[model samples]
Target: MKQFCSIAEILELYEQYGNEFYSEEITQTSHALQCATLAQESGATDELVVAALLHDVGHLIDLAQHGSDTTAFESDAKHESIGAQSLAKLFSSGVTAPIALHVDAKRWLCATNLLYHDSLSRASAASLILQGGPMTSDEQLRFRSHPQSGFAVKLRNWDDNGKALEPPELNFKKFAPVLERVCLK
Candidate 1:
């Protein structure tokens, strides 16, 4: 089975997907780079930064095939989960799990921490409910079971910022090297 996508291949996929679906202010590549930058600045592990960079790779596919609206998933096709599954065989759980659970981590925090749910993005606010709604009691029980709960929280926090209305300028070519750095063994 195919696991990792090469840098060139990933870029080709992005080209077909178009830039409009990523963010109005930044290209998909730029948004990813910003997330990676934030993760690195915060002293997260190298793997975490890589995960941050590629967390939304699945969005590329969704937009390519289904278009930009998260609502297109009908609340079931969590891009995070689809992305995680796609990357799982290529990377460690340390990387994939955060990408997968970042959304759920938000819900987990919202359910257990009173100060959080209110601050979610309009899209996230709605998507969170669709993704399981502020974590059921059972979900809370499971979130605490993870060893990297705190790391997932950080990833989620960075994810929120990655969708900035006016993110810093970034070039896709510059981060191209990162694709190789993370993907090849």
Candidate 2:
């Protein structure tokens, strides 16, 4: 597994690979910044903001593992699980749990909220097939019981809307302090 010993390491990874396209239009960095901005603007906790910032770090990790040949949009990397597990080393459940559950939250939302699936981006809708589509009733019940389900759902919403063509108002550097503050000491 890819290891990140410090916030600087994480930042460096972003600096190096974040320029890659997240969707067809948005770069990974832009997506991250936009998501974090949404979380912050929504008055989310520092941990949630941090989760939003780094929720897709797994994609970066997978890229690093597979090199440039990896087509991120072509397959399911289990990015949510990969990212959450990696981040759990340095952050509490407040952060990692939401990251871990975010994808399942997507499935849950698609199942529970009738309009949610229709609102998904084209790429997201396609990936939903690879992601097992919407959750079944039993799966939805278990997902709702997770302690971080609400936070994960909130993060999923930000993750969906974060794909903006314009530049983000804040950069990764702006989030460094929050990262440090929330890191396990």
Listed in order, each prediction's TM-score against the native is 0.84, 0.96
Clashing pairs in 2: none
Residue-wise C-alpha lDDT for candidate 2, range 41-78, written one tens digit per residue: 99999999999999999998987788657654678889
Every candidate's CA RMSD: 2.7, 1.1
Cα lDDT for residue 52, candidate 1? 84
Error of 2 at 20 (Å): 0.5
Q: Which 10 successive residues of model 1 have the least lDDT summed?
A: 17-26
What C-alpha lDDT values do all the predictions have?
A: 0.73, 0.89
Instruction: Please give, for residues 101-143, the per-residue lDDT of candidate 1 as tens digits.
Output: 8877888989988768878766667667677788889988899
